[model samples]
Target: MRIDASVITPYPTFAYSVLDRYIDGDIIIDKSSALIGTSSGIYAVMGDETNDDFAPMLMHEFKRREMLNQRFTLFSSSERWDRRINELLGAKLQRMPRYSFTFNEHRFMQSQRAGIPDGFRLNRTNKESLEVNREFDAAYIRKYWGSVERFADKGFGFFVTEHDVFAGECVSIFSSEQYAEIDIVTNPLFRGKGVAQCVAEAFILECLERQITPRWDCGLHNTASIRLAQKLHFAAPETYSLYVRK
Candidate 1:
């Protein structure tokens, strides 16, 4: 059964991206007892834990779909949901801490500018770039946004290039009416040259121009990601537990 997205609380922006039809996903509701919003192997679970029938049904569905073998992740909405998932999945679940950061416009404006390195060019992502950029991988956009055409139409990003080679890119992995979640990748050869910051700054500027809030999220152990977010003036880290299949 399809459930109202409004009833699901404390959801990640990706879930809303699915619910709002900005991206393709599944909304699985168990007779109004529980709901699961899923897209691109990421799942958000919420609703009545006291319902005895829901957990077993969810477990069965997971096994039937071979979700564990496919490397799926589940986000818990509360401590109760955490306990419920633990009870159902047991040793199959590996708990990990994830961090989210809120953007600070003032700090971002005050931060030192990210200058493109000599001989490199920063450009907005377009259909042609999406087709030609191999280092950044068009597969990622397809995986998250369902197609290059959709992303090129509704999403935006910035990529760095040197002599026509892809150096780095920062893109909206998920976007809704009001939010754009950032994802970045830099060619290992170009790392430590501020390539990431350059593209990220461009992406953020585009988001701001559109009045959409930019979001940053990463695993707790991803020090590099945390550092970049902080450098970009994304403040106030809120930590949460992310559950993945073992």
Candidate 2:
């Protein structure tokens, strides 16, 4: 009963083509849908919608995503499979702030504007600038920026940075789904000096302005990413393992 996700198409192919670069391993495709689950990080489906009857398949996927964790499942969801997800979420968020990352919405935005250094600036993509910028991530960033822009009306926005071409462009993603994902890749040439942190703080502020949640997630082994998240008050971590078909 395999499904051909490519033919049944849920999310657009254009988006997946771009994200393919970030995909780490082998992919299993079914006519029903494509499971872009992971064993190391966030397991997500790209705008995929189908197979609402995954109850029988939930546990397999949980294991597929490495959520079984050799002891207790670390990540999983079953459509009416169990009362566990609700229980887990309730316990995890209990007594914690409604929005673990929501602090001063108004003040956060103000702080971003105030903290801008004399030479540093942030703004939306200018097609003209992207057309001529022949740098490393410049082209990719332009593409990525455009991808995020399509969803801008859905509460996603990106701000490009050119402080150091070697360090790569700073990146961020805001979603109505209670998260402003911060992704930064600082080239080895620009290792330290708080550039990533500065942008992270600013990104958070932007999400706050739009009243969305800010989530900072990284591989457990990436201590540097964990440290940066902590610095920007995304200290709390929700740990989970993922699996990629071989």
Candidate 3:
């Protein structure tokens, strides 16, 4: 049976913890688990792998709910369900390789931070600045960060500006008590000038100061992101699989 996001809020997975805040009723909670769907597709599933009915129940409800599409990505936090999902879906889907990396505070402290270029200023994202920078994509910001007010309270972000114009941003795409996933973008005019790196460094420092580890996850093929993560001192990447609609 479907229940509230709050009902599954204590599932003990980083994915679920992050989803809890923005689900806003776009989820299904059974006795022991929950499935969250987004406009893009099934975003994540959280439950006990040991439960015999867990996988089946998830599959059943996912079909019954008529989620956005038949083909989409699903995040799995447990290995038990990974095999079960693969066996059930088989070649009807494609397995995509991705990387998950996290910061080691000790190692990060020993690394060198990138320097921001001259004439650029870094600032924390706030309601006032966000309004002034009308160029920032409103829909994209809302979809990833939720309301700007909530972001200010629960997450952290930094943006680099050049002569009072927006240049780039490094923001927490998903955050739980223990970790904050980093997301960054650079304006075309500012690309190749290291603006992204500087902003990302600011975001990382904030996370470290607050004792929250920074996380970096990206597709294996995303070379640019991989380079940035390595440069920022993220630990070696670990491989994981997810499904993409065929």
Candidate 4:
């Protein structure tokens, strides 16, 4: 039985609940309230034993979508869901381990008054900057935040500039009332100069002001990101796994 509804009704799953904030349109919720699909090519099942019963039917529906060779991750928590989804997809799933770090507000505030690097100024991404800013990569704006207009209107980000040239940026990948996940990228020329942290510091401080916690998650193998989180005082890592089709 297909449940024809857009905008996933409120649930406790961190994955789906936070999704509504990032996405601008409808989130399809199928029967059983377990399978949630997005127009952005992402299909996720709520991570719980109760939702396990819907796995087979959900896979069938996904196949019926005839998405061709388009790739998307199956996000879940149960190993049982993983196995069943693998069987339905007819492929060995690629297991990717990830770690999530909790925010340390007090530590973040330590650099509240910190100064920007020499010759560089810090600024928030606003409609004016987004419209006229040529220093930032246009592709990156689309890939991470969907578009410059969205980021300017609904999202929060900080960019560092040296003489009006982009140095680095830290932006909210997505946010809910409880937490906001951060994504950071630095221009290659300014990578080793601690530019990423400067902008990230600004982002976290703003999150604190708004009473929203900042979240950091990265692949287990991403040592650079892990270290950066540590330097920013985000510790106590928790492990989670996601299923990817090979």
Instruction: List model 4 lDDT by residue over 1-246, tens digit each.
Output: 343224443222234323545544234454444555444444556534345455556666556554575555656545665566556664645777788787777776674444578778999877666554544444555654567776565567889998888888776766566566788878889887878888888888788888877888889999989988988889998776666667
Q: What is the C-alpha lDDT of each candidate?
A: 0.81, 0.41, 0.68, 0.65
Off by over 4 Å in 2: 1-149, 155-168
* TM-score of each predicted structure versus truth: 0.88, 0.49, 0.77, 0.77
**Per-residue alpha-carbon lDDT of model 2 for 1-246, expressed as tens digits?**
343434433222222322343323224444443444322333333222345443334445545444544322222222321243333233431111111222344444444332443454544433444444334234554343344233333433233345634323344432323344555665465457454665566667666676655665556677787666555555445443222322
Highest lDDT scorer: 1
List the candidate 3 regions with Cα displacement exceeding 4 Å.
1-42, 46-52, 64-72, 78-80, 90-93, 131-136
Q: What is the TM-score (0 to 1) of candidate 4?
A: 0.77
Better of 1 and 2 by lDDT: 1
* Local accuracy of candidate 3 as per-residue lDDT tens digits, 1-246: 453434543222335434555423256566676666554354566665556666676667556544544445677655665776677665555677788886677776787777788889888877676666534444555665556766667776888999888898877766666667777888889888889889888988888788766778888999888888888887777777676667
The better candidate by lDDT, 3 or 4, is: 3
Model 3 lDDT, residue 165, Cα: 81
Clashing pairs in 3: none
